[model samples]
Target: MKWMQRARVGSTLTLALMVLFLTGCPKRPEVVETVPRAIAPQGEVGMPAPPPAPKGATSGEKSPTEVAAQSPEAKPTPEVGAVPEAKIAEAEARPEIAAEVKALGLALKDIYFDFDQATIREDSKKLLSENIEWLRKNPTVKVTIEGHSDERGSSEYNLALGDRRSRATRDYLIAAGVEANRISSISFGKERPFVLGHDDSAWQWNRRAHFAVSAK
Candidate 1:
């Protein structure tokens, strides 16, 4: 009977030891990898979005820098060298009579007459011949023969003498091949003396026929 009881007690101890061993050790926690979720910032509804950055220029389109560089630069006006239109118009409108007169006055010598006579002096014939040659060469030119006298005569007498002198000069020019229409005559008489003096030298200058040229 003592042996049977001891055996039963040993079996009971073994069962108790097995139950303690199973409950004492716990399972390791599972190593799970949790992924984080992204959260967006909150804003007011109905608000407009910001504008996008400007795009780069295409091959055919010009950039702001290129457009500015291609712009035309200001240039200064050039000075004109040609004759004025107004002057040319005026010259064409009026015959160049004054210019021709000035030219002939400068080129030819005056023709002188004898004291108290309408006849041209022998010495003045050569000068007259030269003037005739010039008139013949320039057929388009016209002339005005102005006769002057010494202050020794009366106004009426001097004026009559001057007319005769101018007429004689016109006749000589006409005979020397100058056209009659091209020659005009005028008398200044003693009213316009070349030199204001009472001497032969001064009288010689005053008693003269002057020539003025004009474009026909």
Candidate 2:
């Protein structure tokens, strides 16, 4: 019986040591799972997202359309009842042109011709001399000589005669020191008559050389 009691005490001590070793080993460090902390995006991390850049604006500046709308020069208004400069200049030039036409009519005269004749008459020489003197005084004035014939001849014949008459007048003016370049001659034949009649009285007036102002 003493041996058996000693065996039992040894077994009890061994069981106590095993129980303490199993319960006291710090519980295998508890296998805790830790999640990685979240980080913000690159440029927008802490900056409050820049207040959302107004509806149509860009980079915190007003949009081009909006800026233009607010500008003073966006829609300019012209003055009421104001004339354009071109219109004003045209209005001022009209009177000057009328004066030029009036002066031309007052300065130049016409000379008459005889039946089937291109040579200048004795009576017309005095008037032609006066015309030559006047032309010499106004060197800058350019004139055209218009020859007209009576309606007695054919259109072709009258036209030829009118051209000869005009050429005769032009030659006379050139001989009296007028520039050939300044005098242009044209023939009307019977197309344009000064006096409208088939009689000699009207025909005399119709056959003439008329001087007209070309330029100054």
Candidate whose TM-score is highest: 2
Q: In order, how many clashes per candidate?
A: 0, 0
Per-residue lDDT over 1-216 for candidate 2, one digit per residue giving the tens place of the 0 to 100 score: 999999999999999999999997876567789999975444555565344456765676877888888998765335656676656767887656667966875677788899988989888888889888888888888888999999998999999999999899999999988889989999999999999998998999989998988777
Q: Specify the highest-lDDT model's number.
A: 2
Candidate 2 — which residues are off by over 4 angstroms? Answer: 1-95
RMSD of each: 17.8, 14.8
Q: Whole-model Cα lDDT per candidate?
A: 0.80, 0.85
Q: In candidate 2, where is summed lDDT lowest over 10 consecutive residues? A: 44-53
